[model samples]
Target: MQWVLDHLGDISSLGLQHIWLSGVPLVLGLLISIPVGWLATRTRWLRGILITGSGLLYTIPSLALFVLMPLVLGTSILSPLNVVVAMTIYTIALLVRSVVDGLTSVPEEVARSATAMGYTPARRFFGVDLPLAVPVIAAGLRVAAVSSVSMISIASLIGVSQLGDLLVDGFNRDIAGELFAGVLASILLAIAFDVLIRLAEHTLTPWRRVQQGGGT
Candidate 1:
């Protein structure tokens, strides 16, 4: 506690960097995953290939991915971009299946009704399919968000500064206070991500609230 308070400024700066490292990847991953996921849903064969391939990506060891990012991306080993890109790959790997499942969760009859009402494929996807898929997609995003926050700490091993730095430094120096601070901060950040995602899910699914209200 004393150590944390003493290093408050450094801790705060690292927390912001941690947020940037994790948050940017999450946004970029979702943007990329939506189209990829949608394309997968268009064909059975492609669906099997994309979902299976992406799932395999998540199985790669995180530290190995972090080390390999510089080689793959031609970025400096110490460059924050290496972490960002690697994290984005991970985020996409985790979320693509969720996107596919969410989109497919839409009822077939509802989709046909949208088409019969003169909705074009694009319009129907964005207007009808997406809204209905929000609940499931949001559930996936919550998992991705927490995972990102926890994983970004690994970047510190390769010299990208973030909350993980405290964990490493504390362990080496035998400073229990600093180590505890790092663990506590990481947990808090994960919880914050979960809460924000839940709030966004609630906002996007107003009908859920209405249903609960009526049932009550």
Candidate 2:
């Protein structure tokens, strides 16, 4: 506790960096995946290929991907871009399948009704399909958010300044307090983000609550 308070400034700063590193990728990935997922649904032949390629990206070890990103992206070994790009790739890999599943989950009868009611493809997607898919997509986002938070810690190993730095510092200096602080902060952060995502999910999908209330 004393050690944590003493290094509060360091912890806070690194924690913010960790959040930023994780968050930017999640946002970018979400934006990118929505369209890719839509396209997958629109082009049935391409769905498997798109999902398979993204899944392949996830198989590369995180640390190895981080190390390899610099050479591929022409960035410096220490550049934060490496971490951000790698994290974004992971987020997309995680979310694309969710998006596809969510969109496809819209019942065929409902889709046919929507079309019969004069809803264009785009209008039907936004008005009918997307709303129904929110719960599933939000579930994926929650998982991605927490996963990103954990993965950012690994970025510290490759020179990015994040919460994991404390673990490295603590280990090098034999300061268990510092190590504990990092681990504790990380767990709390993940929980906090998870709760926030859940709240957002509930807020966005009011019908889910209504259904639950009706069931009750």
The candidate that achieves the highest lDDT relative to the unseen native structure: 1
Taking the tens digit of each residue's C-alpha lDDT, what string does model 1 give over 151-174? 989889989999999999999999
Angstrom error of the Cα, residue 174, model 2: value is 1.4
**Model 1 bad stretches (over 4 Å):** none
* TM-score of each predicted structure versus truth: 0.97, 0.95
Model 2, 179: alpha-carbon shift in Å? 0.7
Task: Report how far residue 107 has shifted in candidate 1, in Å.
Answer: 1.1
Q: Write the per-residue lDDT of candidate 2 for residues 35-122, one digit (tens) a residue.
A: 9999999998999999999878888899999999999999998999999999999999999999999999999999999999999999
lDDT values of the candidates? 0.92, 0.91
Supply the global lDDT for candidate 2.
0.91
